[model samples]
Target: MSFLTVIASASLLAATGSDSIPRPAPSGPLVAPVALAVPFRAPVDTTKRARKAVTYSDGYYKRVAIHQALSWAMLPLFATSYVSGDQLLDKGDDAPDWAQTMHPIAATGSAVLFGANAVTGTWNLWEGRKDPNGRKRRLLHSALFIAASGGFAYAGSIADQAEENGAIRERHRNVAIASMSASTASWLIMLIGN
Candidate 1:
């Protein structure tokens, strides 16, 4: 008798045979069709995959911290050595007592600092030789520092000669300055890199 009832009757008649009778409609509201709904799925497991492990030696971080601190300490020592050495060169025996005393003291301090750094750095470098990260930078820094060390050693060997000969004194000063410059450059590379 109504529009929905007629439509329901037509659907029921179509589903059944021509001779079959139509069923009565329910008294509730109409429900929407669910034919287009997607089926449910479980998440895939990722924990079973294989992976490579990378590790560092014991005390690696501690050694790195100490190396960095010693590097920072080198700045003041370098400045003191340079100033005192310059005064000693310009004034010869007339140089101030403090300058004369501070020169060797600062030089010794720098040498000790470099020695400690070299040991720690070389050890760490060898330990991490397999690591691919920053390999080039580390190698360059080590090379520069090694060259500086040799320059400092040569200058020290000529110290006695430098005291007696003006020419040797100038060469000693030049070598020391060059070594200091190389060390400074190496220090800067690490500082900027990190």
Candidate 2:
């Protein structure tokens, strides 16, 4: 997938980044999700765990496990941000003062979550680059994530500016939505590939 595919997912693309490649849902009992990768490396290829060559480092695995745990912990924060933000975006004008007050806080919450993703994500990606493996889907997924980070950052920075100017507000909302949507696509691609 190209970076354009990620950015354009706001309207122009579907799963796998482009409409050209349709992503059909798997039909059957729900399968397990991708086990999070090790913080600075990949885990034992559990699909091949029976092979002696694939082994896990307890210390490193634990470290990776912590990052993974934190990543999961972020979902609620992001969800809270999204829900509150929508409340603010729609019917914000007549909403109670408390609702207006909470909007920025919610956005901050999501930004905090994004911070975790940005830090650990880039760190892991840098480590992934040592090998030739990120050349395909990993490369695409990582690139899109970086782009999404920029989008969220821009949106977060302009929240105040948005309230004052119609143009700024529109831009803020657009980028924020696009960023989250694209980031989700990137995540799914990597997850399913794993």
Can you write out model 2's per-residue Cα lDDT over 1-194, one digit (the tens) per residue? Answer: 44444355535554456667543444445444468986775566744433223333454455456556665664565566566666667765775676677767766766776677667666665555544543478688778878888998899789888777878877888898888788778877766876
The superposed Cα distance between candidate 2 and the true structure at residue 105, in angstroms, equals: 2.7
Point out where model 1 deviates above 4 Å: 1-53
Clashing pairs in model 1, backbone N/Cα/C closer than 3 A: none
lDDT of candidate 1 at residue 31, scale 0 to 100 = 60
lDDT for predicted candidate 2 compared with the true structure: 0.67
Candidate 1 lDDT over residue span 141-170, tens digit each: 999999999998898899889888999999
lDDT of each: 0.88, 0.67
The TM-scores of all predictions, comma-separated, are: 0.72, 0.59
Model 2 lDDT, residue 71, Cα: 51
